[model samples]
Target: MSSVESVEEFRAEFRGWLRAHLTGGFADLRGRGGPGREHEAFAGRLAWERHMAEHGWTCVGWPVEYGGRGASTAQQIAFHEEYALADAPARVNHIGEQLLGPTLIAHGTDEQKRRFLPPVRAVEELWCQGYSEPDAGSDLAGVRTRAALRDGRWTVDGQKTWTSLAHEAQWCFVLARTTPGSRRHAGLSYLLVPMDQPGVQVRPITQLTGTSEFNEVFFDGARTDAAHVVGAPGDGWAVAMATLGYERGVSTLGQQVGFRRELEALAALARANGALADPLIADRLTRAWTGLQAMRAAALRPGTAPSTAKLYWARWHRDLGELAMDVCGAASLTAAGVHGDPYEPDDWQRLFLFSRADTLYAGSDEIQRNIVAERILGLPKEVRA
Candidate 1:
């Protein structure tokens, strides 16, 4: 088939599947699980994902031999966009399908691929990332997690903070200090560790939204097989960075779709509450619509577009959250339920609270500015303390 034909076919097929499947009990799952709302209908969502896997819909971007459709880039983006448009539940295995799966395909050994890819494609094994620490959130080079090779196993010891969905994950792809004296990004190894072992402790950190999607993971002598390391030992920074690159890849097209849905819903709320009469609110809404268009265009570009895209969407979403509150008027200040559920924020409240960290997490706005400055504009590097 021609490229255009294939993309059109892929989009049509995916849209049809979503319309057919997102019905009955699953119908209620629409627009439920994403970001801070990951705890919502998790089991149902996982079941939905496994159902997608059963129908060859999961991991469409992966090679056919690796249990994927070997879909073209355009096809993948089309799938994401259609999925979001259908209001499907947020995917539970996105970490596996989007990040680690591609990283393994690039850097992992054949044995590693054989052992891991099937479960990931099957949606049977969930994964989390272990990168940020108390000392190294954005400055990932400052990671202090240590892993030592002894007796054919890598024993890890350290804390990783802000680990998304670690409590629900069965495995974690970790970047740890493998050499004792190594500093910064050197001497790190990317190891896949099991999460169910006794040495791994997961403590959920409740966010301002009253949810615990973010977690603090303590690895006290946690161990993985020596063969679990991806790429050469003491050279994991490159592999880790590659995963970060994937984090900003085509899946973001889907994210923008979700963002568009949010904007539409916020606009409806404003119209219902007469908030659109306010010129300030109206202007912000118009700017938001234009910003989304700019984000879509930037995301289609190459190179530093990912960093720029992240900055654009994060700031835009955070402002949208603020706009949501303004649209809702005084109702945004109160919880949905009565005194017993005083902390149970409404959707707009949750959005505002959760989005406060959008600019701070992943890579902070400051870090992104530095990246654009030094890498894109050839600016001098920032001095470290």
Candidate 2:
């Protein structure tokens, strides 16, 4: 196939492969084999990761020397768009692949790359971020998690909040302070930590929705070999910022795509409940659609998009959720996916609940706007020491 034809062929062949290989519960995401089931969910997740890894999908954006397909940015984007349309679950090892893996490619030692990349590419060891602290949500630089190098090892101590997938993850790419007496942003270092060890404590945080996708992680003298540092000492802030940028920026739009889908489902629900006729809901729907479009356009930008797309998603998701709830009305009976929908049993009820986090996690909407205003807009900084 020609280059152009190859991409098109990849898409067509991929769609068929998805349909064929996606049976036994993946066919209908709402049925038996969805993210709702732990084993099945992880299985489906690993299945896709392995298939992609086999097809060189997992490491598409990585360089050829690092066992990646070395696919172009545009091709990668197209692959993601198509994957989004196919309703793939979030990669079980996104922290490994999306966050740490890339940083490793850019900054890791040769030993680190060879040791970490292949396992990450195969989804063997899941990873999570050890950022957010009880006091350092938006103000990441304020994180108090300190790591002191002792003899030939590092002793880590502190807490991390809202760490997603801590329960299932094997390791965490952590940002901890290694040098003392330096400013908040100075002297910090990034380290890869094993979650199953004795020094780490995982406490699940149940949301208002009664599900705990994120957890509070505490470390008391967590020991690590000094060899695990991602880069030079004191580079943690920059590395963390880059990771946050990737999360909010266009690099990892899988979650944003998830939000877009949730928004789409909301629209369909409005039509079914006759809420499409409600002037308020209709107006809200128009706004939501516009917001989603803007998100898509923003996410498609070539580079980091300079401007982050998180705030847009945060606003759009919360608004869309409220709109869906309103259209369902007061008489709506304990609405849920199982409650009722004009089409399939699945809809945005649970997704609406999930959207509440869109603003809070991955830096709040307030934080995203602060970033855009201060950094992108060159506005005055917020006043507070």
Candidate 3:
């Protein structure tokens, strides 16, 4: 689309495209893959995403030269909102497209952009984040994963836990210590390492929802080219933070759409089950609706801290899940099985279970609060022991 195109035009174009193309083959995929439901229709979702890439729909916010529309912020928001309204399947390559792709674009060499951005834009390659470790999740600077430069390559050796989609990714952007004896945020290098090699192993960590959307990745002497490092060597903290910043960017509007849908459905369920008659449940539902509106307002407002957004949404969603359980009352306690599986959670059960990690993942509530305090509120930094 031309840069001059209005946001509504962009929204209409995207909505129309989804209407025309998300059919027959892709119809079943609508609302299939998302939080806790990622295991649903994997191959089909992948195919549908690739199809979006074919029509210049994927990576709409990226630069046009990098196979994107170079969409404005308003246009991007419109795109996401329209996508959610259409009930499209959750994207399969968000780690690549949102986090790594933007990081590479900003800090990567020209060669890196040429080699990496195309595949990410096309959804031909999948990527995972290798930032969090078993012992250093929220304390990202305490990463112990080490990469040694040897014979024109970086030999990485360590474990990265809670690696989302590591099993499906072709590569991972890892933050590993390159300088020996380096402590905390110092001497780290961001290396792009291949996931298909023998030195790399991904063991799925079954989540509370009884699915393994994330994994523990063991990098036993995993190797990547020396040139694969983004930014200067031993300066990975900034790059990693940049990736995290991108992680919370424009795609959130789409997420809000999903949240709204969940809220509406919960409201309906409450009415159906006579839970809405209770004043407490009704009051909670009203608050949820208003809170969602506030979230949307915060998102559009310029200079609203990203940590603030993350903190608000994570807690809200987790609360919504709890509210859902309350609405279900006794029904939420029991599991419903299909196809002889002894343990199958209904939607409400799954929401409650999966949302338990909402405040913990991405960045935990404590960490986000710290960020807001030190950065936005001008509070003193917490002293390290």
Candidate 4:
């Protein structure tokens, strides 16, 4: 079959599988978990993901040698788009399957890949990122998390804030200073640390959504095997940046699918509630639709910088949240309590509150602008104190 034919076939297969399986026990799980709603049906979502893994659906993008199907980029995109269209529960292993797994494939030792990839492919172990300390958030070079090599083990001591899913994760990929006096991204190492150890403590942070998807992780002399390091001791800055590249990669196509859904639903809502009659609201809705089209084009265009795409989508989503509240008018102020909990927000309210952080997380709007300015536009670097 031609490549186009193959992609279509793959899309059909995935769509078919979702239709057949997302019923009976899993019927209610549709749209159960994502963003601010990560607290919803946690056990059910995990179980559904594991069920997908059992049927060879988890890490489709990894090389076949590492237990993936060795799927091509087009095929992987098809999988994600179809998965989103099916409204499959938000994936539980995204950090493992998308970020750390690919990082290991690129920079990890043979032994490291052998030890970690299988559990990730099977969803038997969940992973979280250990970047973004309280002081170091987007300025990763200022990381004070220190790890010392001693007697075949690395002892780590530091705190990581805004660690998504840390409370539910079994492992974390940590970037820490390895040399005593090293500064500004020097002498850093990326270590794979277990989250279950006595020295590790995970405290969940309740957010505007009234849920605890992000966490504060404290590591006091946590230990990982010396072999857990991904690359050479001082090369962590490079490896960490690579992981961020993957963060802004093809999987974002899947994210855009979700964005399209939100836009469509919001439009329907406007029509039903008479918001569409307001000329300004109607104009903003039209602009959002056009922006989604541009975002999708940018995602597919070759030579498009990730920073540029990140800046656009983050701002667009944040603006969409603001528009969602405006569409709701005065009613957005009060919680509808559609869910059992009185404090539980309806979808639009939740979207508005949760997306307020869109511009802040995943490297922040200011940081992304700096990257595009300095690297892509070839502008002079910003002065630092």
Considering every candidate listed, which one attains the maximal lDDT? 3
The residue-level lDDT of candidate 2 at 137 comes to 88
Model 2 over residues 1-385: C-alpha lDDT tens digits?
A: 2134466666676667666765665554422222222334566666667766776567666777887666665666666666667776655666787778788887889999988888888878888899989988888888889998899888899999989889889888888888887767898899888888899999988764545777999999888888888889789888887776555533445555666676677678778878889898888878877877777777776554444666666767777767767877773436444425432223345445666776777777677788888988899999977
lDDT to native, each model: 0.91, 0.73, 0.93, 0.92
lDDT by residue for model 4 (167-271), tens: 999999999999899889799999999999999999999999999999999999999999999999989999999999998888889999999999999999899
Q: Summarize candidate 1's per-residue lDDT along 239-316 as a digit string, tens digits.
A: 999999999889999999989988999998888889999999999999999999988887777654678888989999
Sort the candidates on lDDT, descending order: 3, 4, 1, 2
User: For model 3, which pairs clash?
Assistant: none
Sequence-dependent TM-score of model 4: 0.98
Question: How do the candidates rank by TM-score, highest first?
Answer: 3, 4, 1, 2
Pick by TM-score: which candidate is best?
3
What residue runs in model 2 are displaced by over 4 Å at the alpha carbon?
Answer: 1-7, 25-40, 249-257, 303-307, 331-347
Q: Residues 161-228, candidate 3: write the lDDT tens digits.
A: 99999989999999999999999988999999999998999999998899999999999988999899
